[model samples]
Target chain A: MKNILIYLRLGLRNLLLYPMRTGLTVIGLGIGIAALTFLSAMNDGWLQNMKLNFVLTQMGHVQIHAQGFEQSRRISDYMGDTTLVDEALQSMQSMQGGIQAWSHRIRVSGLASAAGANASVLVSGIEPEREKDVSRLHTFMQQGTWLQPGDKRGVVLGDVLADRLSVGLGDKVVLMAASPDGDIASEVFRVRGLIHSGVMDVDNLLALIPLKMAQHWLHLGAGVTDVVIRTNSFAVVDSVVSNLQQRLSGKPLEILRWQEIDPMAEQWTMFAEIYTWVVLLVVIIVVLAEVLNTMLMSMHDRVREFGLMAALGTTQQQLFAMVVYETLVLVFIGGILGFLLGGAVSLYYGEYGLDLSQYATAFSFMYMSSVVYPELTFNGCARILVAAMLGAVLAGLYPAWKASRLNPAQAMREI
Target chain B: MSDHVLLEAGGLCKYYHSGGSDVAALDQVDFQLEKGAFTVLSGRSGSGKTTLLNMVGLLDTPDMGSLHIAGENVLALSLSERANFRLQRIGFVFQAYNLIRVLSARENIAYVLQLRGMKKTERLAIADHWLFEVGLDGLGNRRPDQLSGGQQQRVAVARALASKPALVLADEPTANLDSVHGESLMSLMRDLNDRCGMTFLIASHDPVAMAAAQQCVYMQDGRIVSVATP
Candidate 1:
């Protein structure tokens, strides 16, 4: 321990011999780490946003539907009012620790006409009070008010649909679809709200109406298209699904998690993670090369110094250890500073957010938000720190070998 | 293997490849230094005085020779073993490149003891004692760059003798000092040799070094021509 402390002191003193070079080398490494951490933090925040806006807001935590509803995908193939399923959901709220908010929704795709313009869209029948707890749709009102329980003829149009139809708040629109009896059914509703959900597909193709009104027009009679349940957090979604499956076993319902229903969201997250690893690997390699270059150059300038140590009986291994110790100190200081600086930048972004809302058209189309928050996690910081330290140790290899192999007698000759 | 002999180099030969010809730097050179002797290897430049010192110091290997320090054949030791033995037994004082510039005078002296696994408190105490012995009692904290040339040389001398080695090898010990400083350093070394019975084998062309030596050997063309007791 004493020897190591002495050696470390010596190594630090040696580095102090060339302050400018040392600082430059450390800054080079710090830049690499900073870039790595900053990009990683941004990716983490993007994934979280995707989960919030694209996945949970749209798919909920879990969805239950009739067994054959998936195969047909028909609005008329709605679930019947099963006392058994209703009782199971009621029991779940009490028994399951993960259950947060849940709501029943009846969604159907059909053609709607407003004024002289018409377009195809998916219209949802919802309970206003319950939906506010289940999804973010209620908060996205761009114009006018959302549907009320007492407003039977009220309708909320996605901003994209309203734009295509050239309709505004209070404009009336007619909804048309085929009923279960194979007959064409139609209803006229006044536009109560125009919502911009920050999702291109949803904005272009979604609308909402009161559930009681939808049941009255479609003759569903206490039937719902699907039951959506939200868990407390995404971390417990699988467990919630599993527990629900056990309770609802042998029933005529198919339960699916958000990830299972929207595989694209899961795939996107995986791709982002892989991309992060590739970026981190490239940054580490670059850092290693830069550190190696600096150490080799420093070794060249200290030929006589190394020879003196060797003459004083420093062994090959001890010389190699000194080189490694020197590189470690450089990397340790640089990496820590990089982590802190990157964390600070990300924290600032997290608090104030990075606004890209100006690109609303392009970003909204793909279910992305213009405002992004960069996130930094303990796991990410730890992984980057480990990688940087390993890079430093590996960078010391050739230089340490060169120093260890020096002949003290010949090295002093050049002095 | 005599008890009085502190260092022995028998038939030591070292060759250098220069000018497309093999030059014998130390050709069948046989030398011995007894215990408590202040000896000098005096020769003109390129007469192989430094090479002989290096060979005896174990800084380089001989093509064919045997070297024994304190009756142990150190040349037969492994490369790493030779390094460990050098730290454990031998000390070196170089003329120009002597001290490690990064360390203070005390650290340079205690560096060997640290390598030998000495405790920090004991190592510092011993280093301080050696610093006082070299007439730089309170200047132990000064780095090589901070000390004058004469003081630095004294520190180098102190460092070489700090480990209490069986023999001290000095190559051109006074080549970098002025006449007055060189004479004073030589007198200090001679006093140590006389009073403390430290064995010193120094290679130098300095007349003062030759005058202070109890036994001086002259070399010409990689071979010893004569030995003098002046």
Candidate 2:
């Protein structure tokens, strides 16, 4: 440790003497690290947004179903006694990260016809009061009103779905689908609200109606097709699913987490994370080059000094260790400055959010909101820091080896 | 196990690959120095004086030579062993006064002791003793560039002898100094030699340094021409 400190002192003194070169090298490395941190924060924020608005709101954390419903997804495969199942799920809250909300849903593929136009859509039968607790459907209502318990024939239509069908709130529409017992069913419903969730799929093909009304229309007889659940955190989804499966065993129920229910959501999260790592990988590579160049430049400049040390009883290995020390000092300092600059930018945007309203049209962006808040997590920051530190050490190796390889006599002959 | 000689070098041969042909830097040179003798290898430019210093310092290996320093045959030692030999047993002062410019005079002298795995307090104390011995007492805190040529040379000498090596090789120790500093630098080395019985083999073209030496080895065309006791 003492020798390391001395090597660091020597490195610091050398860098101080060549301030401009060291400053420029540091700035180069700093820019690379800052770019990585900023991009990582952006990726993390996007992932959070998806989990919050898309996954939790639409898929929920876990979805419990009748045994065959996961395969067929048919209205006929409805589960009975949803409240009993929900109560049972709540018993083991330790593994669930605590369930936030759960809503019984009866979803069916149907056709909507209104104003002499027709379009295919998924009709959701939900208890308005309970749905509001679990999903963003109520909040996304852009027109009219959410369903109230007493309104038997009331319905909510996605704005784009309604547009395609040439219908609006207050307009009457006909919904047709297959009944549970294999009968053709049709119902006349008055649209109560127009919802535009800003998600292409949700906006183009979804409609909501009262649970009792759907139960009557589909002849479900006090049964729900699925029970969508929300938890406090998505990280415990796997454990929650396992616990729910174990608890709901022997009841002909197939409990599924959001990752299994909506595989694309899981895939998208991984994709976002991988994309950020690839970008950081490139940035780290460039930073490594900068560090290596700085070390090599210093070695070239100090041949005589190195030789002098060699002749003065300092071994080649000690000189190589000095190179390592020099590189670590340079990289750590640059990494710190980089994180500060990058963190400042990320934190500012994280607070105020980055309004991508202008770029929204140009960029085919994902998630529901145009504004994005970048996230800076300790885990994420630590990963980048570790990568930067390792890259710096790797960069130092070649230059250090070259320094140690120098001939003391020949090097001493240099100016 | 050998005689009382501090350095025994025989059949030394060195060649440099120049533009085309190899030029002999040392031609079968045989040299020996007894313990505590102050000697100089005096030669003009290209006379291989620096080459001989580098060879004796173990900074370079001769194409053919058998070297024994402090009774150990080091010519057959590996590269790392040669480095260890330099570290533990030999000290060198460059013609350019190659004091590490970044380190203070105290640090420069102490660094040699540091390499020998000496304790910090002991190393600095020994450094201070050498500093005062070589007439650089209070000026130990100054960096090489901050000191004059003479002072830098004094610090270099202090650094070399700090290890108390079996032999010290100084290449043109007075080549960069004027008459006054040159005489002072040579006189300081002589004084250190006389007081501590330290062995010194200095390579120089400067008459001041040559005059201060008790024995002079003259080199011409990579071979020793004469040995003078003055």
Give the backbone clash total of model 2. Answer: 0
Candidate 2 residues lying further than 4 Å off, grouped into runs, are A81-84, A93-97, A359-368
Top-DockQ candidate index: 1
Going through the candidates in order, their DockQ values are: 0.73, 0.70
Worst 10 residues of 2 chain A by lDDT: A359-368
- The residue-by-residue lDDT of candidate 1 on B83-123, one tens digit each, is 88889878898987688889999998998888999888898
User: Per-residue lDDT for A96 in model 1?
Assistant: 62
The TM-score that candidate 1 achieves is 0.90
Per-residue CA lDDT of candidate 1, range A1-415, in tens?
3367877887788888999988888787778888888888888887888777765556787888887775577876788785676677678777865888788888887889988899997878898989888888888888999888899999998898999988888889999877667777899999999987878767888879998888778888988888888788889888878877898898788888876666677787797889778766866796698789989988998898888888888888899889988888888878877887888888899888989878867766445678889889887788788888888888988899999999989988865
Tens digits of per-residue lDDT for model 2, A296-326? 8889899988888777766678888888888
For each of the candidates, the C-alpha root-mean-square deviation to the true structure, in angstroms, is: 3.1, 2.1
